[model samples]
Target: MEAKAFDTRLFKRILKYTKPYKFRYYGVILFAVSLSVFAALRPYLLKQTVDEYIKPKDEYGLLFYVTIMGVVLILETFSSFFFVYWANLLGQDIIKDIRIKLFKHMLSFRTKYFDNTPVGQLVTRSVSDIEQIARIFSQGLFMIISDMLKMVVVLIFMFYMNWRLTWIVILAMPILVYITRIFQRKMQIAFEEVRNQVANMNTFVQERVTGMKIVQLFNREAIEYEKFKEINQKHNKAWIKTIFYNSIFFPIADIISSLTLGAVVLYGGFHILDGDKFTTFGDLFSYTMFIGMLFNPLRQIADKFNEMQMGMIAANRVFDILDSDKDVQLDGAKTANHFQGNIRFENVRFGYIENEEVLKGINLDVKKGETIAIVGATGAGKSTIINLLNRFYEINSGAIYVDNQNINDFKLESLRTQIAIVLQDVFLFADTIHNNITLNNAEITREEVIEAAKKIGVHKFIKSLPGGYDYDVKERGVMLSSGQRQLIAFLRAYVSNPSILILDEATSSIDTYSEELIQKATKKITKGRTSIIIAHRLATIVNSDKIIVMDKGQIVEEGTHQDLVTKEKGYYKNLYDSQFAVDLN
Candidate 1:
């Protein structure tokens, strides 16, 4: 995408997030203005002390003025503290809200969005990118405004003191401004590169760490480390570019500021030598101090401007996600409460990619309380059927009905609530096993959860683990074996008391003992619910009411296991023979 200029519309949209905390935001602005005013008064007070009291050698009067200066300093300190504290608090609060909103928005997206996008990129957005936005509030926008206000107030006081010197100070500003503009443009590009490289590095590390076993198993750690080094080098180079621009810009600003100060002293010295009454010694001293104050804020503003640019870029990325139309459709008005388990797919055709169908005009009818087993080679659209039933992806052209009503007419949440699925690979949160099972559903009480686990026959296994049901699964259930995780998934699905249960090769990778327990649990769970089993192991599903044989996204044969096995040239018989023929011999 082409880089966009600072967008006012995007800024206004970001500002809308502060609406709930407008009072705090406004208070920050108030403190910023107060700080600027206090800062501006310091030099003016110093000028008065020098010209009015010090010139006459009035010790007591000088002490009184000095005391007032001390008082101003204390007040200024308080103002500075309040400004920094509230500004940061406001930034933190705003970003916190934005992160939550961003995460919730992501949850509404279709599964296809996640399939195409990297998880690390999303992580960067929610964490680092949002943090950059906080800098906009804390160190970028408000600080820039405060600095500018201080400079403005200083300029006004300077002109009031001596317009001739003030005009000289003003003359050198264009040079600093010109240099800063160049720095701004260059730093913007550099910062953009830095952000991009950070995201790239994050994606690389996340994927590698998650798949470290594969990397080590294949002995490719050295190769992967070299790749990481290259990405890290690029990230370093991008930051160095920003540093280079800053090095050039700040020095130029300092030089210009110094030359301006020298010019003021030269002019005042000549006036004093000529016995000019208007250019007092105190005036020169105060102007020098004001000049220093002026240049400092100008230099800081340039840096803060760069920070603001980075924030804008981050906001743009965040808005891109929020503005996307790829979210799952949720416009269905009918609720799926008390839906019968009857399901039918009428000429269902779907594809993850255009012009490449995964499920080609499929038609299937499943009655309530029937256990149907679907068997097929990989890529035969067996799993696709379950995905479509759950509406994870929208079918390109087809109609799916539950209980004779179109599935699309049912509310997405209500439709999904009635179904439970256990995939070949299970996912568990870094939470207690009880939370994973009940998913923190208050409706499912602790006793009810234990009862469900007991019914599924995995209660003993869960109890054997340290902390039993309260065991912390740790990230992705790394603390547990595959079979143990799968058993937890079974308990989780069972406790929901879903109207439809789907086990898509859920028993594929478990041990024989776990498989036996799963088989018993499966029989109990599917007793009165509509269940769909997609299995490669035909033995596990032989007693199913119907066995469907699929090839190339089409159902080739379906019948009772006994009836299908009787066919001499049947697909099911061939599949059964391939595995059990040796046993028969």
Candidate 2:
């Protein structure tokens, strides 16, 4: 669709949020219309008071007009306050609604979507772009309406008071408007570039901050700074364009306004001097006031037009996210309320990117309560299997089943609730250990959390910490050691007690002592549940009931640890020999 300064389609969509705030919406409209009338009436009243009372030196008449003018001023003040209040209130509420919808929409997207998208770009859409959209109501759309209405009323008064003086001001308008139109479009284009650079800057900063450790570890501080400097330069240049337009436009607007006001006064004064008693001093005063009122709004309308343009640009970008559904994780209406954890993959084929399959056509099955171990070198699609089992990404072609029922036939939440995973890189929110373990699940009581931690054998270790279970793990659990974070993650997954558990190198990040503890905990947890263990360290999965060796997205071997190792040239045997110096016996 062709875009414009006043995007009708975008405007209608933004207005949809006002549905719930109809009271405030109507309040703004009423005040905008009423305030215009009140503002216009003041100059006419001043003309009347000056000509009818102040001119005659009539004491009672002057007192009466002064009292009425005071009341009008009081009323105008109240109306102005209400108008601004309702407009801002409406804007704030609408943005809150839009932000919530945006967040919820993002929640529906699959992990593949997040993998391909930058974290900072999403943050820009959620916060920065939405903020620009809010200006549509608060400082752009409603303000423009109020100013335009005032302009119309002032023009009516100008024509009534003196048409000839009105013509003087009117003649100067076309030039200002023509320039404003050009300025508005320029600002729109500049603002779009500004938004793009802002998003790029956000993406770079977010990635750098999140990986600050790596930057410092690898002595990349200077290099990253140089790269960021380049991005920052682009960001500044983009903003300067918008600022340059504003710097040029507003001054030109002010000059035109001054010239127009001066022309009205000069014309009015000359006519009055020419014995044109019809153009009285009162008429001249009102014409000057009328020019100020009319020209001021014209300049303001031009400024607000830019604000609305920026807002429309932001809305268009944000709507791109809102209207997206293709990447949203599909869920069925039927719930997997009684899944048996009997997982099966039949010739699954999938890829993170088009034409680049990460998992080739493969088939596998795990019976209920069966423990299987998958081992492979890095990039052998070890983690991809876990991702597929949990349905984090949609397969290009495949069928996955639990208890002989297709995974697609079950609700996403219902299916996921029955399974849990502990990753190599565990993420812990900045919260107390108890909250992180329970995940604020109200149904899981404190006693259950304590019991689960004890089962994982981290209960005493946690109790030894500064605050025991109440200890606050700072952002990403940085306050805790890597082993401690891994322990917390293990505890978190155990507390949920899903029917299926997948541990992806769960013990790889831990110290020797923690690994021993986790091994013991692992055995206890996997005793009677379906478990899939992905490991780089071959020693960790030596006792698995079945071992699967994968290479390059395809499973190459599958058998018990003893059975796989007995083969001299098996993939599992080769991986085991490389990981261990001792004989396979």
Candidate 3:
């Protein structure tokens, strides 16, 4: 989307984050004003020391004026220090709150939002982009205000000293202002491109690093490196464009400032020589200093304003996420405490993409404590049923009920708290094994975690590792084996004491010993809970209370193991005979 010229609404929204620390914000402004006043007085004091004390040849009076000038310099230094300190403090505090809020808002987005969004893009927004926002407070807005205040105070003193000389300097300001406006416009577009390229580079690096094993296995390093070089070139070019604009604009400003300085000196010298008492030597010296003071801040203000524009561009990107309507709106208000395990999907239809339905009018029913097995080909909608059951995605049409009330009628947290899924591709955070198991849930104590691990039959294996449960997984559990990660996933689900358990191909890809342990753990955990198993291995589900055979998003057969096997051309029978018969032979 095209960015607004000056988004007043967005500006107001950013201001809201500062309200919590308004006292500190006020302190920054107060110091900025004090600094500006001191800055203006320095040149004026110089003028007085020259004209009234030095030129009159009074040593005591000159010493007195010099001491006062020293005092003013000290005060100005103090003011400048406090201004910088408080402005930075305010920026850090405000950005801290904003970053936290942005992270929490991202957490609230639905599964589908994450499905299409890149993780590195989100990381850029959370880390790099939010940092730019902090500069808006520290180096951008507050600095711009302080610079403008300095300019105003300097202009007042110059006019008071000699309005005619002041006008001479003022004549060159229009050119500087015109150049700055053009530079700012170009810089805004360049900065936007830079931010986008940074995100693209981050995405590429993150993906390549994450899948480095696969890249190396396929010998695609040279190809991927070439791709990275292309992206890096674009990133470099975007930054160069920003530098190019800055180069053109700052020199133009310098030329204008120098011309103004020359004009002030020439005009003041002529008047002084005229002997009409039109301008004093002290006035000429002070006016020269005042002109530098005026234009120097204006130059810095241009730089600060460019920083502010980049911040606004980042704010636009961040606010887009905050304002998105794609979040899964939680409409259910009913709490699901002490939930019964019964679940039913009635005429449910869903599609991750529009017009390409994954689950088509699926109907399912499970009793309070039944174990149901769903078996199908890879794309036959078996796992989609579990996704819908957890309310990860909204149904395109129809209703799902838990304990006779619509699933949508339950509060999202309460509903999710009662359901847990252990996937085939298990994920573990880079934390202690204990933390990974309990997920830092306070209610699941250390003792209870150990007990859950013991109950799941992985306690001995865990204790065999270094530091036992205290061992760090180290980034997606790379330190652990696939079987070990799966075992951890099982323990995580078991500790929750969920009313409904989902094992989505949870045991398919694992070593034999781990499979044995998981099979034992599965029998214990699913004893009284409503469990749904989506498995590719036919042997695992033979003893389930009910077995469902699905093909092309529709269930074609439903019965016990023996009942389906007796049918000559049944989908389930064919699947079983093809695998189990070979095993027996």
Candidate 4:
């Protein structure tokens, strides 16, 4: 997680999002300034009451002054309310926009990014990290502006009332600021460790939960529990360390403030006793009150300083995603109006790292209306091939051409709009069945959705449900069986009617009955369209126009099923023999 520390430049870029709401920010500042002025006047009114109204036993004048003081207090409260409301509103809006953009940017990232980054850490960044930043932008902003302004006004009033006493009180501020800086740096480090530990805990929780069935089957519950306990313990320790630093900061600030108050009393008392020309008891009292007010906001600001530092750290992490250069840029012209489904990979070499190439000078051609099946052993770059075809990763060398044009030359949306993929792991939203099929597009009619569902043989099952197409599927479609989930996935992809279809182990998870149904539906859906099927089960591709056997990232053997099976020494022949032997048993 330390390796994931966000760049400060990226954090600064995130601050630019606040530019649009500058007027609201100015309103906040104005409110804070008005409150500060009101705060500064309170002491003066008290001084006047002591010197003029109280000294002469003037009850009416004292009552008038008290009423004015009460009015000022009311104004300060209203100003504070408006300041907080507006700042919070702006903060929430900015956070919402940032969250939306960050998610979108992450989705746009190359698949290689996720290959290295954990999904739980990414989720942590989007959730808690964004929230931490939001707190800083909202409450933190109000406190900073109000404290700084109030401090300035208090300083001016203190100096005006008595310069000699003011100097003594102000001297403690340099020490206070130094202490604040030290605490800020230390808290920043501690909280950063805390954030990383939280991410680790989240990753552990997600992995354990998602793989609960596997863990149970393997009888590794105790092992996972210990692992999670260790990560959670680390997070707790980090939190304690952060609180320790924060606790030290406030008490030290309080002590310094106490010492400053003692000094003010000693110095100001001496001046009054010595009959100093400009100092009066009333003025001295007012000066002391103003100086005392200084320490409160100062200590509060110091405490909040830690919060701001923590927030900046979170902001930096979030901004890293927002500011990232989207790997699949759609800046190019949307030059391709329609795809003929011609795909060619020419001398393409690609890898996650510079030196270790996963795809090595690969060459392939698929003509329109051809259905090709790609087969390979685990980690032989089978999934990588599909990922590249979808532009989820870029080729390090050479090119991929769609419809005989370099894929990079077309807008990413335009290129992707022509392709549809159904993955083995089906992803369904927690929404109505119709929304899942049409993907919540109001423009896609209910009739069109049912037609696609029927094409994929899912209409009957969906209709069997009590709500029919309007039925709600729980998160990840947990309400549906794996085969039902696959049926809905097929319908979604089929409904898109993409020019090029990719079935990446799509039928691998479904039951044999469902697979047969899908196999039938695919014939109608894939008619006169280019389709690529990647399957572990060889029987799934027996009807493909060609079957390619990939080994070590290279096509070792390729031909129609009969031709490849007839080649006695070929990899496909061995694969078919092994599966056919299993089927016979």
RMSD of each: 1.5, 1.8, 1.4, 3.0
Report lDDT (CA) for all predictions. Answer: 0.90, 0.88, 0.88, 0.83
Q: List runs of model 4 lying over 4 Å from the truth.
A: 1-15, 266-281, 284-288, 326-331
Give the alpha carbon lDDT tens digit for every residue of 282-355 in model 2.
Answer: 88777667777887888888788888888888888899999889889988887877657788999999888899
Best by lDDT: 1
lDDT of 3 by residue, 245-283 (tens): 988888888888888888888877887888847689888
Q: On residues 1-585, what C-alpha lDDT tens digit does candidate 4 reach at each position? A: 233223456456656878988898789889989988888889988888887898788999999999999999999889888888887887787888889988888877777678778889999999999888777767665777788899999988888777887888878889988887777667677888998898898888988887898999999999988988888899999999988987888888879988888887787788879988676777767876786678888877766665666677788788677677855344457566778899998988888787988887888889999999999888777878888877888888988988878888887777787888889999999998888877876777999988777766778899999899989998889899999899888888888778999999988888998998889888987889999999999998999998878888787888899999999888988888998899899
Model 1, 1-585: lDDT tens digits are: 335546788888888988999898888889888898889888888888898999998899999999999998999999899899888898999999989988888888888899999999999998999999999999988999899999998999998888888999999988888888777788888889998999999999999999999999999999999999999999999999999898888888889999999999999889989998888888898988999989999999889988889998898898888788756555589988876699999999999999999998899999999999999899999999999999898999989999999988988889989999999999999999999999999999989988988887888888999999899999999999999889989888988889999999999999998898899899999998899999998889999999989999999998999999999999989989997876578
Residue pairs with colliding backbones in model 4 are none
TM-score for every candidate vs. truth? Answer: 0.97, 0.97, 0.98, 0.92
RMSD, candidate 3, Å = 1.4
Error (Å) of candidate 3 at residue 1 is 11
